[model samples]
Target: MRQAGLTEALSGLDALGRIWRRRGVFAIVAGAVLALAVAALVLLPVRYLATASVIIAEQEPGANTSAAWAQKVGDPADMESQLLVIRSPRLLRQIISSPGVAGAVVSECERGRLLGSTDACQRLKTDVGAFIDHVESRFSVASAGRSRVINISYQSGLPDVAQTLANALTQTFLEDQRTEGANSREVASSWLWQELKQLDQQLREADDKIQKFRRTKGLMRGANAPISSERLTSIGQQLSQAEAARAEAAARLQEIKSEQERGPTDAPSVLQSRTIADLKQQLTTVSAQLASAAGVLGPKHPSILALTREQASIQQRLVEEMQSIAASAQKAFDANTALVNSLKKQMETAKAEAGSATLDEASIESMVRDTEIKRQQYAELYKKASELETERRVLRGSTRLVSLAELPSKPFFPKKIPFLAAGMTLALIFGVGAALLADQLGARLISPPVPVTPEAPAQQVEAPAADEAPAIVPELAESVTAPETATPPPERSSHLPSVADVSILACLPRLKSLREMSALGAILQGHQPLAIPRVLRLASEDTDFQHALRDLVHELGLKRSARSQRIVVTSPDAGDGKTTTACALAEHLAAAGRRVLVVECDVSHPAFAEIMALPASPGWLGALERGTPLRDMILPTAHPSLDVLPIGATTGPVGDILDAISLDGLLAGLDGYDAVIVDTPLPSQRNDFLAGTDWAIVCVRSDRSLIEPAVVTVNRSRALGARDVGIVVTMTDVEHRSPPVVQTAPVAAYAGAG
Candidate 1:
């Protein structure tokens, strides 16, 4: 179905092409339209525009300022924070209040308000939303390409305004950035100071609490020490050893000291005391290092493991050293104590060694030296902590701005030329469509033309020969006469006279003689004589009219006969004009003339009188009706050249009339005739008159028939037969110019008479 539709569409397009070709004016008109369009386009001026670009640099948030949190929140939230600060009432107010910007904005706002309202400054500030709005509005900030740069461009009606706005925007942006940054930095610094101070307080409080806790819990410097089962067990074993050693050393030392206090022998006591003190001090150092290592390197550390190993090694060493020291102390104490004990035992022997008063004062000086060493270590650590805090405070002050916007040099607006072109093009298309629509709706002319064929020519066909009688021909017969003039006379008219009358009068030709008139009228009626045989037939069926017509023909001597009768039988009326006269006249004239004959061709209404008249071997109608030899119709007449015969019975309901072709045969059979008068029916009322004849004369009535009817009768007879003949105009008025004379001539009899 679709394919059929497409085929039809293509056919329609072909037909449309034919239509367009025939109506080539349409194409010319369309071309003219297009040409005018091109002309107009050529006439239009070209326009140019200048452009400039600006970049919007993205300012990343400070590293420690929750930027990661801002990203998870999306750009709008971050941008809103940025936008709020940029478009903040205070900031917008600040821009509006700025040096030059304030006056310009106030003037613009006043102009705007003047165009709208009356309140000045109050309305001005309210309308100065235009400034914030202008930057946020005029400034188009879009992320350009795939980069982090946002493009910010400003456009205005004027290029200078565009440049000014661009510059102003860039300046505003820098100021906004700087102000925001400085404010932000100041706020951040102040916040940092507050927070840092609070945190410091917290730190000091934590330190104080930790210190107080350490002091209250007796955990002084070894607070991080582990007290796992294995370490505790090792510590317990070391403690037990130390305690045992101390107990033994104390026993020895006590014995020595007791001896020193009781008696005066102090060397052994002092040495024992020094050895105990050195051993105890070495043990304390090892214990303290082990605790420190345990605090520094928890239970899982290699250092802790090393500490444990070292502690174990130290425990053994300390035990051995303490035991060795204690043994030496014990020996000294034993020796001194034993000596004292022995002296006590020998009470009197010990009494002599008791002088010990000088030793106590020097020992007091040694105690004071140890107290000085502890105070110096505490002072060093406190000073180091203060320096670290001061460094931290200064590191927070340094901040910098990294991005800046530059001013643009052009506006991005109007685009008037392309817009106008588009509008005009659209308008032209619509105009063409309207023209086509109007053309379709209006009436148009239709042309009429003649048809043509390849085979046939264009001339009109010839009508029938009978119809051709009216058609004019220029020919003459010797038996008749020539036309006196080439053209006919015009009738005179009495109505509105004009020069047409004079032209008509000038073209009329003079009349001719009666004989000439008769002959020429016969010729004009379309009868043409083929040869110049001097015989005539005045043939008709009616006798009286025929007799008169015969006398007229004889007076004219149209034929020659012995009896002086050359009758041309004719009619004044049907059956009234004598057909018998044709026979009688022929018989009378042929007495002196040569052979004469009567031709009978009125087959439908035959009036041969073969029964009434004398019978013959074969009659004229017998020869004609049977289509037999015309020689048989040349029966014996009284005249020589003339012939007389009677018509046969009616062959059919109508006469076998002669036409152009059949007349040829009828006339061909009359080759021997000097005079052959044919008897026929009346032609006016009955059409079988003069069916066959050599020449004919009409037998028209004098009173009853008009000359015009008689003339038409003569014309009609000439049309049917009588190629060379004349009208007798019988029974014409006696006052006519030449009255008819009753005369007869039989040329056949005339030949016989000679």
Candidate 2:
């Protein structure tokens, strides 16, 4: 597990190293990209910005103008409305048509088109609409942070132009607001004046109608207040008073009459008579004189009698005046009673006139009140009209300017630090992307396409050539041969494929020392080939490698019990010790007394002739061309029961020699061999040359072979009739190298599944 993990880590490192090595390939191109980015940042036009702010004050109570319709300050809706007014097209058009604003926008456009071939700048110079659009695109209006202030901002390449345009827009907005306000006031005044005239006419009609109603109702005016039903009530009250006065006078007169009936002097008025008072005073004076005379003369004196007579006369006159007073009182009582009756009839007449008129006193009173209300309304309308007329001349809008735009000292955009930073970041990304693209294009240009084999129709052998050998039954062919000399031993810690799909027949250890070979007896299990017979002894050597090799050979014999046992050996790529593996397996079987043949079909880089130290000759090919017996072509090997058959003369790129001689006939000639092993080059390259073999001994270079291509080769071998395949992994230097696994086991079985 540790070894496999190390192998994956090493593979990842190798991939990274390959990528790192290509870093310099695109460095110059990437630097040019960055340089262009820097130039763009430096050469692009800079723009200046200017802002003007205005505050929208809250409306005061009791105000009656357009300003009064405004909401309180600090309200979002109110702030938004102010911004809307500033940004309105009508106001914007006025600002755009300002004396210098349009010219500045055109100039900016002309500057922007300096490098272009088009006459857009020339066209815009004469067009106000294009200038206005440009101005609007650069201008911005927004409320300032939840406040009632609205900010008007403008951007331009020229600092003075930005400031002038901003100030102009703010000023234009204010003037437009004032103009609208004045127009609104004038309209309101006109409407109010017309209303006042109508109200005045209504009031006059109401007053005149009230008078006509009073005349029809017979409700006359009183001395203090108007006379209506209350007048009738007053008349009734007067009648009642007159009746009460007449009753009191009559009662006094009756008492006086009673007194007069009893005696003239008994009358109350006579008792209170002024004539009796004066006459009594005179009689007293006369009685005083008579008493003086009687005192001097006799009791019947003339002076005394005269005094008495005068007193009686005064008493008589008093009685007469009392009677007269009582009669006057009776006359007064009668006149008062008649006056009361007249007043009561007058009251009844007034009520009858009011009732007959079909206008009740209450109705008349309501009419009077309504008429007064009309007069009051007319007066109020007159006052409001006058006020609006005066206000129309002086009314200002709700918007007030808090500040005007100032000239900008610095450009708002194309700042040095920020632009450079942003440009650098973008250039870095594009540079890397461009570099990778260039590398890919270069690789595609450098490599050529490899030709893949097409699916050919099934056939054992092609027609014989001019130098042909006789054809024979391919099934009658015996198995292959082995080499005379020993091949290279399997390296240490060798990786082998799994024994599941393809049984790994052998996994030999590295023969680093005598200690490593001490357990050779156990690994060979008494079947050590004569090619490697001398076993060096060691002191207490580790035998784990012995168990591994023993287990491999045991598994091969146990698993490979089926028919069609002719084994073909190949690799996915070269340098996998393909020939060495075939030779070793054949040697092991032959030394065990099982007759084996190892045929070297790989003429391009054949190892069998070299390993046997063969003299230069045509090998099997020359013998066939010479029509020599097939038995003589079979060369003896160092192993008593093993033999080698080399591919003669070098086969051309097309390998046409194999077509001239019957490979099946040659194999059939090996009738005595117990088993056959054919050593060939990569199967994928040769295509399907060894299709007759039932099983394969595929060699894999441990820690180096790509499993995917190896798997492809194995699958292709299966398609070409090699079944019951076995793998022999070689050159595995696991003790010191990476990917130190014992075998190139099935990828899924070893990939963390356990």
Candidate 3:
């Protein structure tokens, strides 16, 4: 698991290295994106933002209670509702239609006209709806973070205009709230007044109905009751008096009768009479006189007889008076009895009349109750209407202006520091992404070649004998080198090539001075050999360049079997030192006592004749077309072991001859050489000769050749069946005379192609 993780980490590092190697691409892409961002920032129009705030105070009219004043402020739903109301179309329309607001918008539009925004200016001037829409786009309203305060903002190119519009919007909302409250009260008052009038009419009609009912029923009210009721009471009182009088008279008559039965002298009536009393007095006097006379004249005197007769007469008068008193008592008793009977009959009649009056009074009482209720209702409504009118005059809204907007000193949009920072960050991200894409798309070359660990050995396939395959031309087999000697090659050495030397050569610094080039020329002269070109002769010296070449050969040797090898040297473009590298490698192989063959496959621009210092003659193509013996076209260099087959003078396109005569068959005919180096043109130009080769070395010029084509050449070589592929960076500047330290660690292959 740990090994797997380390491998993954190394893979990631390798990918990043590939990107870093193409830093030039990152710089170009990032620079272009940043420049575009800056241009857009400068060209954009500047806008100023101004804000005004209001505190929403919700309160009931005429309410001074602590509960009402301390009601929870800024209910979330209520605040949201209020915000929506402020941004409502009706309120916005009113704000835009106001004189001050309209003028400010007009001024802004006119300013726009001067600034070449004629279309917008003309549309705003001609269409009021469009003007409103434009203003709405710039206007904004929001609550101030869980508080009752609300913020209204506006954006405009002109700072003063923004401030004016923001303030106007806030003022308009407040006024609208006040006006809405007043209108509500006014409507309520109107309804109350109408209701009161209806109640008044109902009360008057009810009173009239009561009065008319009374008149129709003949129900007249007295102090405490109806008149008929009062009369019934009076008759009852009179009947009671008559009854008492009759009772008293009857008792008197009875007493008088009893007195008559017992004799008139003991009767109460007789005793009460004045005439009886007078007669009694007279009788007393006579009796006294008679008694004296009788005594004096006992025997028959005339004076005594006369006195007795007078007394008798007085007693008779008293008896008649008693009879008269009895008769008067009877008459008075009878009269009282008749009067009581009459009063009783009248009381019965009055009771019947009073019963009818009671029914009528009940109905009148119902109407009177209804009338009273209507009157109370009318009074209540009248009072309420008055209160509503008073309240409407002092109505207040739930919002008040907390602060007016001030003119902004700077634009809200296009903030310099933040805008540039954001732009740069985005540009950098895009640049990195683009660089990675370019690397992935084969637009950049692979990283410096690394020494790969040797894998399982490949099975060696013996080459076919020259006599077994048919040659393209009859003389091709005779042109091949003689067979290898019977002696086996020297044993393999234990010394491994330095990995650091190869890396330094692959990532060389730029050669900036002519002095460096002259120093390189001096080094070339110091290591001269007569048989090879001056450029190829430098490989014999123990320099940094020579060590890089040896490392490359050692790395290739690890991949190949211990047998004859075929190597192809090519480049992504022209003039990348492809020929020099091919010749030098061949010379090195010859110096090591190996028989090597150099075949110049670049027929379009062949350079072997001049490099070999040989006179012009019919090259390989001339010998092929004329069917000349292949052995006659074979040329030898000063090195007896290294030979060359140069591309002769051509009459037409090299592609047609190459297609007609198979190069593979021609190479197969050669059997004796230890190694064959075939130098070809750019991979894009011609790559048919790359197939079936043992190794392909792509030559790249440091700081001059692009990584894109170099990477392309490596991939193409691998695709064309080259058993192994590598890169060599040539023409690189040397910083010092001394070589770099050799690293013993085995290097990894190029991440892109491997």
Scored by TM-score, the top model is 2
lDDT of 2 by residue, 603-657 (tens): 5676566666556656766676677865677787655677777776634343545
Preferred candidate (TM-score higher): 1 or 3: 3
RMSD of each: 40.0, 24.9, 27.4
**Model 3 over residues 1-754: C-alpha lDDT tens digits?**
1223433454567567767976888888889888988998899888999999988867747635476456545567778888898888788777766656776787887876655656666666557678778888898898888788999999999998999899888888989988988899899999999998888888778777787887887777788888889989999999999899889888878898887787748666567778889999898999999898888886367788788788889988877777777788788889889989999999999999899888888888887887788778888888888888887888777688889999999999888889889889988887888878888666335543334333412122122222211111112122232223212212332122111111111321222223446877756742332333544544344255554554456656722456778888888887777887888777766765678888887866778898887667677788777877655777887878788888888575566454344346567667688888988754343446456677777777644412446555766665555666666666554531122223322221111100
Give the per-residue lDDT digits (tens) of candidate 1, residues 565-681. Answer: 222456546532334345444544455334556666554555444422346444544565577876665555333454545554434543334321233345464555556565554
For all candidates, the clash counts are: 55, 15, 2
lDDT of 2 at 61: 30
By how many angstroms RMSD does model 3 differ from the true structure? 27.4
lDDT of each: 0.42, 0.61, 0.69
Q: How close is candidate 3 to the true structure, as a TM-score?
A: 0.47
Candidate 1: stretches off by over 4 Å: 1-147, 181-185, 202-417, 443-754
- Candidate 1 has a TM-score of 0.28
Model 3 CA deviation exceeding 4 Å by range: 1-42, 55-57, 63-85, 113-126, 215-217, 241-336, 424-754
